[model samples]
Every structure is written in structure tokens, then in C-alpha cells.
Target: MKASKVLITGVSGFIGEALVFRLLVDKKFIPVAAARRATKFQGLCPVVSLDLNAPEAFPAFDDVSVVIHAAARVHVMNETASDALSEFRKVNVDGTLHLAKKAAESGVKRFIFISSIKVNGESTPPGKPFLADDVPAPMDPYGVSKREAEDALKQLGSETGMEVVIVRPPLVYGPGVKANFLSMLRWLSRGVPLPLGAIHNQRSLVALENLVDFIVTCINHPDAANETFLVSDGYDLSTTQLLRQLAAALGKKCRLLPIPQRCIIIVATLLKQKAVAQRICGSLQVDINKAHELLGWVPPVSIELAMRRTVDHYQDKQTK
Candidate 1:
């Protein structure tokens, strides 16, 4: 694949920001970033204001060879079920279809979609990790929306001649990360003893840098077209192990209380917080062997390094 112009949506987001930076550094390709709000990275690339939900809002795909769609409504608590489904369809599914159609119309070569592992399922069974070929059984509105978006992209690929690549990442974390991951980091920083120590369930996660690398590799990888991949850091850790690693990264001794899982669940059930308990104690893992065999891509950073970088960013933010 030759160096070509690329258009990336949600360039201000965590994965998007890292991706744009990587693209900017690549001398072969020129990057055009599209988002709803203006970004401080104006000097990095051509920034275009685009509202993907608007029917008339379509970027100039004429000169672009690849379109990387990374924008979506990602908050779990900020939206109701109805609102989430509606917004996800408008942005994740409909917006994706619109762009893919335009990409096909404009003679774009490839369309890469950044999807979530939740599309596979929220929690994996006892000993089975999610595989790329497994049937999608989304557990939440957000996952359903992503699965729909993937279906729409696949349909576009079949109807038109455009190549589509879908990459599903699990729990992406690194610098500039927000949401639940950040909350956990804050708790660790406060030296709070969390009951999560009792949960021995394993969860898979990806480093933002590794995810960016995968996205870039998908741009023109011959084997990635019309394929779905489940990506991770190639490792899984329990909640207790995760806190210990996070504490190590922060140069602090781990302070975790191993409260019995059954007791926690019982109390949470009585308090109507079972959902929260499930999120913390559930086991979720992804198998990325297909990605390795197809794209020959491996995570370049270790989990420890990634966590250290994440902690460093938080320290920098606190200092500022």
C-alpha cells in the first residue's frame, strides 16, 4: 500500500488523539481530522468540523484513500437506555453508513471502524475467551449499537467495492484517558482499600498506543478487509492484580481489602447496586490470535509501561 491521504473521525478522543499523532509522524500519509469541536491540535493536521448525524454533514472524501471512524457516544452512566440507543444509532450506525456510502462514492479504498469488545459480550464465560468468529451477543445498548454499525459497514462493503476493516478493542487505557479507569486511578491515589481484591475474575485490556498501531495497520493491510478482529494487550489480570500493578506504577504500596465476594454481592443486591458489582467482578477476555496471524501485529508496549505512562499523565495533570 502506498502512502495516501486519510480522514479520521473523533480526532480529539483518547484513541483518536493518539492515532492522529501517529499519522502526523508518518511521512507517507497526510491526515485530516474531523470532529464536532475544534481541537488544540490545529497545527498537527487539517481539522474539519463535522456533525456526523446531520444528513448534509459529510467530509470531503474525494482525495482521501482511507476513512477511520472512531467517534461514538461512550458514557455508560450519562445516558438512559432509550437515549443511548437513539444516540448510538444516530452516530455509530447511521453516521457510519453515511460516511461509508460517501467513501464508496468518492472512490475511497478502505474504511476502518473502531468498535468495542462489548459487541462480543460484556462478560466471557468461565474458561472461554472471545474469538473473532464468535456470534455477536451484545449485553448493553452501546454494544448493540456497535454491532449494528459493524453490520452496516459490512453491508456497504458487499454492496460497494470499498474495503472495510473492523477492530474491536477492550478497555483501552493510557494518557488522557477518562471515565471508569480514571476513577479507579483516583481511588488508588487516595490509598483507599477497595473490596475488589476479593474478585478473582480476569479482564483483558488494550493500551491506547497499541490500539493506535492496530488502526494504522488496518489502513491498507491486505488481509484486514471485510474482517473483524478482537484485540488486547495479550494478557489478562484479576481486579486485585490490576490494583497491585497500578499501585506499583504509582510507586505506592497496594492497599486492598479482600472482602468476601458473596457478602459484597448480597449487600449490593439489597442496595440495588448489583449492576455495579457485576461490572467490577465480571470476567471479560479477548483472544487476538487472528490479528497476529493476519496483520502480523503485536502490542509493542508492555502493560506495566502503559500503566506507568497513565500514572505519569495523572501526576502531570495534578501538578498543573
Candidate 2:
């Protein structure tokens, strides 16, 4: 197959950086890496400056055939903005739709949007996981922005005949991971005894590699166009199971003390950290059956192996 001229936003982001390398190494995509700073992807791939907030500066899309959009105002905890939703909408909703509209007019063949499972809800009830077809009930500003973007993109696709593929992935963790995932790795690496042994909530996660693989699949698969997908590693693990598995992967002993879930939640609540509490005690899972049945896409990495790779990358970072 001929190499596609793929424009990848967020080239400096965690997932975006990983995608750039895969696109190069796989030799399937001639990635036009777009970022606010051209140096982000300098010397690695063809770099272009793209400020989503400034549509006037958006590079011409005449040669681009596919666009993998990964840029957005990601979720921030304890956000300091006075109007958080307004801040998010500026980049996530308005910025995304603007880019999609331009891509559609520029004759871009496909637009693959990276969305979040939080669009389904914060947590899932027992024995029921999030599906792509579920009505969105976003609980936070970030999720609301993504939900709105999806809707706008769907409408744009219908009106302009531009193929749109929406992918809602659960927590994505891997090498160079940051925020909560990185904090967890740091805590585990130092042998901190977490009081999360009693947590029985299952959370689905996708490996960075697995997610990029699926994106590539969507780039070419005919059935993937104009479809929404919920993707995971096809394995679910509770907090206890996750910590234990991560410990094993890091070649360390699991150190978790079984404190009651309510106790943990109460302490977190008193500390004004209900969101953190929910993450620890709540369940979040996504079903990838649609990706499997429709796109014939199975996660290329097993959870165990994925964890090992992630731990290895973390270890390498610590040593550096």
C-alpha cells in the first residue's frame, strides 16, 4: 500500500510521540507532525506548526489525506481556572470542530478522533461496562468537551461526507506516562505500602502501543469510518489486582494494606479530594467488542506484557 500523508496533532504529547515513531518505523505513514512548536517533532518527522486556537495559522492541508487528532485540553485535577468548562471548550470543542471542518473542506479522506470513556460516565455499575452506543453522561468539564466534539464531528461527517472515526479509550498508561499513572508507578517503585488492598473496582486500561495500533487500523479499515469504538486491552483488573500485577512487573513485592474502602473514601473526602476518592473506589471499564467484531481489531499486547513494558520504561526513566 502507498504511504498515506497523515497529519498528527499533539506530536509532543505522550501518545502522539509514540504514534510518530510507530508511523515512521512501520513505514506506512508519512507523518506530518503538527505542534505549537516545530521543535517538538524536529528532525524526527516532517514538522508543522499548528495552533488549534489560531485557525489562521493552521498549515495548508492540501496534501494531507488522513488526520489523527490527539491534541486537546486534557483533564486536569483541581483546575485553577475560574471557568473550567469555558477553558476546555476553547480548545477541545471549538478547536477540534474547527480543525475537522477545515479537514473536511480540504478533502481529507478520514479524521480519527481520540476521545475518552468518561463520556460514558465516571464509573460503571456491577456487571455492566461502558459501550460505544451508550448515551453520554459526562461528569467533568474535560469529558463534556470531548462529548460535544464527538457530536459536532458526527454532524460534520454526515454533512460533508468526510469519514470520521471516534475512539473512546479508558485510562491509557505506558512509558513516559504522567500524572496519576506516573504517581502510582513512583509509589510502587519506592515500595510504598498502599492502603488500596480492599478496593475491588475494576478499571480497564489500554497500553500505549495497543492504542496506536488500533489508530493505525482505523486509518485504513473501511468499516471503521464513521463509527465509534470503545477500546481496551481485553482484560480488566481491580485496584488490588493492578497494584499486584504492577509490582510483579517491576520485580518488587506488592505492599498493600487492606483498609476499608469507605474509610479511604472518607479520608479523601475530608481532604477535599472526592475525585481522587472516586478513582480509587469506583469502577470504570470499556467493552471493545465492537472494535473486534466490526474492525477485527484485537489488542496486540496482553495486559501482563503491557505492564512489563510500562514498568521497564519507568525503571529506565528513574535510572536516567
Candidate 3:
């Protein structure tokens, strides 16, 4: 029997690259890399350049059994676009639907969309984790575009016979992680004292390895069809706990001042960084029980192991 062919969009991206590696390691699928720009895969797989910004540049889905749509116009902190929402919809919504239609027409069996937890909302109230079935309440243009893409995907799947599986993941960490997670690692390694010791709000994070594992499961699992799943590490941590863990992983002493969350927010507001403050101080927990019950999926990597890998990668990069 031949291995199934899985085409992964955004193959040059962090999550897409990781997912392709996992599939290759498992030796269960023939991974096809697709991205907007050229990426050297060491001739490991066939590479196709498919820019989501180009509405008509559709990659040929010949012999593709699964299409994992991981490419998207991710959220921008300081957006300079004239119309941020329109720009986001152009790539995330319109581009996604166009690709899905082509996949469905080409007999692609399953289309696994990598959505973001922002579709559910930015933050969750303490003790009230966001469920997969919750009413979507996107708070920003990026999140709204994701929600629109998801709805459009489901509709397309229904019209055609292709199965659609949506996986919404929170802040993903591990080796090669950037943005806020990397910043935390740097801060801890440099022994910069943080004012997050008093924050008790819970946030859910998924390891990059763990998220790839889940996506692999959705590739062919019958229960994953037409389902929207929220995934995490099954571990919720406070800001203080996360800082402490990163510090330990980097072999540095955690230096966190017990500053009031309110005061930090006030300072951030004054500095025109209230959004950053909310991310650091607010709670965004997701309940992965649906994934557990339906697909019997569990994050294989523990938080500790994930953090260690992240720190090691950061250190290796710095040394080079």
C-alpha cells in the first residue's frame, strides 16, 4: 500500500514546518510543501509555491489525500494596512475558500484547517474555559477573519463531499517559537525582573510537537470529520508559573516582583501597549475535553519537556 499524500500549506512557517517534519518522521504520509516563497526542504519533498495573497494561484491537488491548510495572514500587532479587516479577509477568508474549493473539486478526502484560539475570543473568564462549541466572539479583525474562514470552510465541506476538520490552538511553544514566548525566554535568561508574580489568571498553551501530533490524528480519524476542536497541553499555568518554568528551563533564577496586575495594566495603557498588557495579564483557557472524548487525543509532550526544548533551541541559536 502506498502512503497517503498530504499537502501542507505554509510549509515554510513554524507550525507548518513542524507538522511536515512530524509526518516525515512517522513515515505515514508523502508530505508536499507549499508556501508563498521558496523554501529549501533539502530535496526531502516536492515543494509548491502557492501564495495565499494571490487569489488564483492554486496548487494542483493531484494525488493529494489530505490538505492541511496552515497558511494564513496572522495577526499583526501594529497593523499599517489601510483596512486591516479587508486585508485579513483577503488572505485568510477568501484565499482559504478558494483553496478549499479546488481541494474539494480535486477529490481531496479531508481538509484540515489550522485555526487560532482567537476565533473563540481573546480572553476567557477564570474557571470558564472556552469550549469548542462556544459561540464565536472574535474581538479583533484577525480573529473575525479566522471565524469567517472557518464558517466558509464548513459550508464548502457540506456542499462538496470533502471532510473538514478544524483545530483551534492557543499560544504554541517549543523549539523555534518566536514572539511573546521567545521574549519571555530571553527576559528570564537575562535575569530581567518581571512584574508578573501576582498574576493568577490561567492561560492554556500547546507545545508545537503536541499540536502537530493532534493534526496528524485529524488527518484520517473518522471522528475528526466536520468537527471543531480546541486543543492544549491539558495544563493551565499562571503568568508567574510560566515565568518560573522558563527560568528553570534556562537554568536562571526567577526574578518576579509581586506587582499588582492593575498597576501593570495602567502603565501599559499609558504606554499605548494595553493589548500587550492584556495578553500577559488576562486568562485564555481552552477546554480540550471535546478532543479527548471524540478523538481520544492527548498532548504527548509535557510542559517541562516542551520548555526545555524551547530553551535549548534558543541557547543553540544564540551560540551560533
Candidate 4:
């Protein structure tokens, strides 16, 4: 098959960087890197300086067959912005709409958006999981923005004949992962005795490799047109199980105390860390059956291997 030119936003981000490398290695797609500091992929492919905040600032999208929209105003742990919703909408909503319009005008075919599971709500019941067709109930500013962006993109696609594919993924982790996932790794590596052994909440996570593979599948799959898909590792793990697996990957002994879930939540609420507690103890699982039935897609990487690679990278960086 002939290679296609794919313009990828957020080329410097963890997923974007991995996607670019994957495309390069597969030799099936030509990646046109776009980011604020686009020089990172300068020599690898064509580079374009893109600022999501500046919606009017866009580069020529001529000849780009597909666009993987990975950039966004990501969730902040301690947001200092005066209007967090407005700040997020400025980039994730307005910026995304503008880019999609430009791409449509330029004759781009498909737009694959990287959305968040937060759009489906913060948590789910023990056995129930989020589905792609569920009514959206975003909980935070960042998630609201993504939901708005998804709506706008679908509307734009309907009006302009461009196909839009929205993929909502749960916590994604792999090599170069940051934020809470990395923090968990750090805590476990230090052998911190966490009082999370008794919690039995299930959470779904996607490996960076699995997500990148799914995005590539969406780029040209005819069945993916104008569809919303929920993606994950197809495996749900409890907090205790996750810690144990991570500790094993890091070559450390897992230290956990059988603290009551209610007590943990109460303490976190008192400390104004209730949100953090919810993430650790809450259930957030996604059903990926739609992706499987429609695109015949399955995660090519195992969680165990993904964690091993992540641990290897983290250990290497620590040594350096």
C-alpha cells in the first residue's frame, strides 16, 4: 500500500511522539509533525508550528489525508487559572473546531480525535462500565471541553462531508508516561506502604502502544467513519492488583495495608484530596466491544509487557 501523509498534532506529547515513531517504523504513513515547538521532529518529517490557543494560526493542510488530533488543554492537578472552563474551551473546543474546519476545507478525509474517558463521567459502579454510545456527562473543565470538541467535530463532519472518529480512552500509560501514572510508579519504587490493599475498585487503562495502533487503524478504516469508540486494554485491575503488578515490574516489594475504603475517602476529604482518593479507589472502566465489532481492532500489546517497558525506561532515566 502507498503511504499517506498524516498531519499529527501534539507531536511532542507522549502519545503523539509514540505515534510518530510507530508511523515511521511501519513505513505506511508519512507523519507531518505539528506542535508549539515542532523542531523535535524536524529531521524525521515535515514540521509545522501549531498553537491551539491561536485558532486562526494554521498551516497548509494540502495533501494531508488524515489528521490525528492529540493536542489539548490537558487536565491540571492544581489549576491556577481564574476561569478553568474558558481556558480549556479556548484550546480543546475553539482551537479544535478551527483546525477541523481548515482541514475540511483543505480536503482532508478523516479526523481522529483523542478524547478522554472523563467525558463519560468520573466513575462507574462495580460491574458497569462506560460505553461509547452512553450519554456524555463530563465532570470537569477539561472533560467538558473535550465533549464540546467532539460535538463540534461531528457537526462539522456532517456539514462538510469529512469523516470524524472520536476515541475515548481511559488512563493511558507506557514509556514516557507522566502525571498520576508516573507518580504511582515513583511511590511504588520507593516502597511506600500505601493503605490501598483493601480497595477492590476496578479501573481500565490503555497502553500507549495499543492506543497508537488503534488510532492508526482508525485513520483509514471505512467502518470507523463518523463513529465514537471507547478503547482500553480489555482488562480491568483493582488498585491492589495494579500496585502489585507495578511493583513486580519495578523489581520492588509491594507494601500495602488493608485500610478501609471509607476511611481513605474520609481522610482524603479532610485533606482536600478527595479527588485524588476517588481516582485511586473509584471504578472507571470502558467497554471496547464497539471498536472490536466495527474495526476488528484489538490491543496488540499486553499490560504486563507494557509495564515492563515502562519500568525499563523509568529505571534507565533514573540512572542517567
RMSD of each predicted structure: 1.5, 1.1, 1.0, 1.0
Sort by lDDT, best first: what order?
4, 3, 2, 1
Residue-pair clashes per candidate:
0, 0, 0, 0
- Which digits, one per residue and each the tens of the lDDT, describe model 3 over residues 1-320? 89999999988888999988888889989999998777867488888888876757777888999999999999978899999999999989999998998899899999999999999999989999999999999999999999999999999999998999999999999899988788888889899988889999999999998899999999999999999999999999999999988898899999999999999999999999999999999999999999999999988989899889999999999999
lDDT of 2 at 301: 90
Per-residue lDDT tens digits of candidate 2, residues 212-277? 999999998999989999999999988889999988888888899999999999999899987888
Task: Give TM-scores for every candidate, taking all chains together and pairing residue i with residue i.
Answer: 0.96, 0.97, 0.98, 0.98
lDDT of each: 0.87, 0.90, 0.92, 0.92
Candidate 3's displacement at residue 164, Å, is: 0.7
Q: Point out the higher-scoring one by lDDT: 2 or 4.
A: 4
TM-score order of candidates, best first?
Answer: 4, 3, 2, 1
Candidate number of the best lDDT: 4
> 44-140, model 4: which lDDT tens digit per residue?
8888888877766788896899999999889989999999999999889999999999999999999999999989999999889999999999999
Candidates 1 and 2 compared by TM-score, better number: 2
Which is the better candidate, 1 or 3, if ranked by TM-score? 3
Clashing pairs in 4: none
RMSD of 4: 1.0
